[model samples]
Target: MNNSLTNRLGELAKLFFKMGVISFGGPAAHIAMMEDEVVKRRQWLTSEHFLDLIGATNLIPGPSSTEMAIHVGYIYAGWVGLIVAGASFILPAALITGGFAWVYVTYGTLPQVAPLLYGIKPAVLAVILNALWRLGKKAVKTSKLLVIALGVAALVLLLNVNEAIALLIGGLLGMFWLHFPAKRNSPEDNTNLLIAGLTTGATLKATAAVGASAATASAANVSLWQLGLFFLKIGSILFGGGYVLVAFLQGGLVEEYGWLTQQQLLDAIAIGQFTPGPVLSTATFIGYIIAGVPGAIVATVGIFLPSFFFVAALNPLVPRLRASKWTAAFLDAVNVSSVALMAVVTLQLGAATLLVAKAPYVDFVALAIALLSAVLAIRFNINAAWLVLGGALIGWLFFTLGLYPIK
Candidate 1:
């Protein structure tokens, strides 16, 4: 490799590896951190381009943030950068989760991380809000786009629509609404198109359901190959987000195969949630429980392989999509809708982090951390990784001093 290419690869490795360790909260938080690093701090991409990547990543099935890392890597380096960036980000999370899985298998219990999460969740909210503010400016370029964003947010926050579906709705809305008066199509043609679209969507969902059921019925010994194939299928077709993986695993692993109990599944999800990087790393925990180290390695590789492929295929088309007026409108709407989803998630996280269910009803300390973190990030331009670490330290201190009760 040339010296310049080698240097870029080194940069990708350093940046994503650190992000893997410190990216808490989930995909939204992870994406937010990436935006800060790639767009704001490093200037590796413009906010507009970053927003496009987010829109495109949302349209895909795999982990959005991990794909974003891979997308950024490709933009910076090449196909090699794609693999390096993805592996660098994924390796730390997989290793950390693997260690947790080993402990869970050995001790039959999980670690207590409530306090660390208590502080980290609020700080993550701040980081997400900062990203939303920055990206929304670039995305909501017109009043119509703003309306589409709001409509998508309502679909998700009120109607409980899936986020991926919401993005599709936004894209379609933007496509037709923004590209009006250009051409006229027969009403019959429009109706047929709508019907075909709906039919295709329904067929895909039904097919996935049937596939899951078939896999359940055919459950057998958890061989390395079978486990890898199971996750590979999921990585290719599983949409919505990592949380949706639960239903599939519950049905296939717990109900059909008896490979994992309900509690074990829940604990695996818990470990995935609390740890940094992709929630799909829960596959690592489950694989360790079901098979062994080899299973964990296979599962991690299988579940993440599709994202690398998907991003590589889609990244090159983004600039082309922007080049076409109709597709450009669609991308614009998708971009705004992606931002809207992040907004809704941030609000949900805020409520969950700042409000107590029982006595007191409000977590003032968390609120303070969120507010302070936001101020630092917005005004002082503090790095997100440090903010997350600081939140964890504060949470630990509070827990140690008996200031904050463990959740």
Candidate 2:
């Protein structure tokens, strides 16, 4: 790479590392941090391009924010940039959260940590709401897209359909709409060649093979190996965003393997919101709790490896793919389904905090703070860190005023 490119990549790596460490409040917060660093601060990519990547990643199965990081890497420094950016962005949060998981598992209770998380969850809710609003404004541009988004959200809330399947169906629907527009509909505009080349299964399979190889060589433990393989399978087959992965993780880790308790799993998820980067870094926490530092490494790499492979394998063809009406339609469908998955997750979290769980009434305060934060975010475009801190203050105030005892 040339000097300017090399320097830029270094800067990106440093920024991503900082983000991984300090970027808390789940995927939405992570995205906001990224927007601050990459789009606004560095001006590496246009806002439109960033949204396109978000849309594309949302249509995929794994963590959309993580994939966006990889995409930014790809855009900035090609293949090397992709690896560095993804790895750097993931490592700090993985290590910090994983360390905490290790402590929580070994000690059996997180005494000081619980209060911090209690405050953070409300902020996370605000962060996610802000993200949804921003993304919705951008994604739901056309009337058709709005209809699709609303319809997908309703189906997810009511039908209990698998998110991956929902996204796949959406992609197919988008493809159909793009390819065979109605009389009043505009013709499908294929503008991205890279996405087009990904239409073929053969290319995806090859990418899978590469990902599998990377996964095997990157880790040590047999459990880690299994975790890697499992996540690889999920990443390969899944086609939505971070929220969809939650169900899959719950099934595989909690139901199938019995590696973690429901409580532990939920706690880990809460921790993910309190930290930064990708919500999927919950894997790092799980891995550490299960197997220690090695496990954390395995889980982090296992979870994110597929994104690199998919994006790299597909990037060369996005230009051509963007031009294909069929592909455009497919991506559109996937995008709608992805939002549906988010709606489902939000509902589930709401129910857990509001209806099902009795102990954590602090969640209500969190919700209120989140709502307030969302309003601030939309109206004033405030920074997420400030909002998160504000939520923390609310938590402290509630605890001090005897509204709820600090757990």
Candidate 3:
């Protein structure tokens, strides 16, 4: 109601709208873009506050960047801003992906985006690596914490423990081990205790194979509600990032329900990675395949709906998370854990961009571009968007010159 609040809301809308349109390269780039906007440019919040949002997002199960949008919205203007900011940020990607889905269904195959991704993927990896280094300085404050981070990376990469489970373990250990004595009367202290007590206390299914049985035929008959609920479940409990959705959709949609073929599923993922906004909109593409326009709308909403609630529930406690010694330690552990997971995923994505498995997939040009993007990002301090665009331009140029095929 207040004019000052109204102006801040406008700021949120304007910035997030632009970000929604250009928030390419994926989560790391999105986060970096947000940091540059909210933390560095507008001075709406501190770098510490921004980092806390990032860490808190890791605590939840939704898209981290989208949740952060909701959380930041709450930070600025409570519930109204939360809805507006998230919607503003997600609209562009959903619409673009919806168009792509329409095309794929009309044609048997998705359009080739190999050239665009050829450059974007490596830049994305580099952006994440840059972010990891920057956040690590703040998150890794002690040797014990450093060990916790390394331990998490080991558990995840070597033993293949679930990332959510790893985060839980770190938080629990930090709750006990990181506990420190403090007075109760200070409002800040009370806030921290309430947050540490309540926040830290919040500690939080596979498909079957396709069959020739009658069940197989029946499974293909998915309704709109079934489609929505299906993606809703995936959005709620999904961990390990959007990449993990690959295995999930393959199993559930292709194997269990037989609603999607493996090729369709792969095409959906390609659309997701190639487009902007939440990568989970792959659910939208999958939904359209099962139902229609209504299916796409429902599935998109289902996949992203949980994120708003999670952010609303968790955002208020962030200040407390920053203030309490106990919660702070828990967050520290969580941040380090996040960095570890991020590093592992970045490496995997970077390797993928190399495209060196065999002919057709193999591209020495992509490899060189990736390395160049890394160098430009690291040594020159170029904005990630520029690096991504530069990569795209060069990739298109090479294809145009007839040096390498665009797949």
Candidate 4:
């Protein structure tokens, strides 16, 4: 019996480890890959339950998708599962980013591997688009939900309202519409109230992260602890994945602290994207530059440590929230808002991705690949890793044939 349990734990570790290695295109893609594995392939959780977890992550600070992995780990295998899942998921990216850090420090330049990302980015877009479709179908169940989702998207994409604020407002709207439609509250509204209190408090914490930066004071010599603490704080606070991380790092490390230059930080972000797993592994690259192997270790731990605790603390409440009618409404609001934010990010990324320099018609090859991949995903439900690899090979062939020349 114990061996069977251990084997199950091993499976959890291996699954997340594989995901850590191949998860490209950032958090949306990572979450899509996870849904394929955990919900569709493994049947570990239903789609509805997974949506609840995703919504819960939005409420708390830290990397949302990474926290999703941790939450799944806890749900399936308890505390050990949480550790194994989060660490296994993070390990590959951290090591890859750490190696890049070594290369950067040794060479003073990030490796130029445009062909790989060129192929992978389009494929990732297809995967993310498919995931959004599936989750959006589940999230937007009511006309009211459709309105909330659309409103949040407009606020984020058009009005440029804060994403965190948009999500919180969605939750508040859910609290009223789902729970008190006629100004009548059931006894369980109190439970939803408690859940709302916890979620709002966490949402406020996430909102404050926008202004977060590295500790004040620039120095010619930077300490390992400072690097670790800086990333740890950002990891615990930043909510919108790599996009937000880029701005935070630019301000803190480049402007506030003299540890890295603007170019170096951009180089770090590029390397982070080129590798698999979390883009937050950019911390590993910067950490190794600042200190060394020890710095790499500390930075990775500091950034990810809070995710473990955040999941453990917030995950249990998801079921409680879903179990009650009122809090369930709250979860629905948060879920739609989460998917709405995903849509906004996808639009922004797609715009940036479809534009290519020195190419005829702005990255025609990638656009073709992305369109093809999207059709295949929708029609056949193909595995994402295969699409990524296939995209890479196609890009490499184009480069070799000089059909799509990289200038």
User: Tens digits of per-residue lDDT for model 2 on 1-407?
Assistant: 68988897897798788767656655545675676567655788865556556556654546667777888898898888999998898888787777778778788865355555567666666666656555555555577776676766666667865554455556665666646755443344433323343443442453244222222221234466776676667656554445556677676677666777788788888767656667778878877777787777777777778888877865665544445665655655555555555555655655544342455434556567667777887677776667766766777777768886553
Output the better candidate (2/4) by lDDT.
4
Give the TM-score of each candidate.
Answer: 0.93, 0.74, 0.84, 0.93
Query: Which tens-of-lDDT digit does each residue in 40-149 have in candidate 4?
Result: 87899999999988888888777777889999899888888899899999999999889888888888777767877778888999999998999999999999998999
Q: For each predicted model, how many residue pairs clash, with residues at least 3 apart or on different chains?
A: 0, 28, 0, 0
Candidate 2 vs. true structure, TM-score? 0.74
Which candidate, 1 or 2, would have the higher lDDT against the true structure?
Answer: 1
- Candidate 2: segments with Cα more than 4 A from true spot: 32-43, 105-108, 178-275, 289-291, 336-368, 400-407
Which of 3 and 4 is ahead in lDDT?
A: 4
Residue 158 lDDT in candidate 3:
91
Q: Give the winner by lDDT.
A: 1
Error of 2 at 195 (Å): 6.5
Residue 118 Cα positional deviation in candidate 1, in Å, after optimal superposition: 1.2
- Higher lDDT: candidate 2 or 3? 3
Distance from true location, Cα of 139 in model 2, Å: 2.2
lDDT tens readout by residue for model 1, 382-405: 999999999999999999999768
* CA lDDT, every model vs. true structure: 0.87, 0.65, 0.74, 0.83
C-alpha root-mean-square deviation, each candidate: 3.6, 5.7, 4.6, 2.3
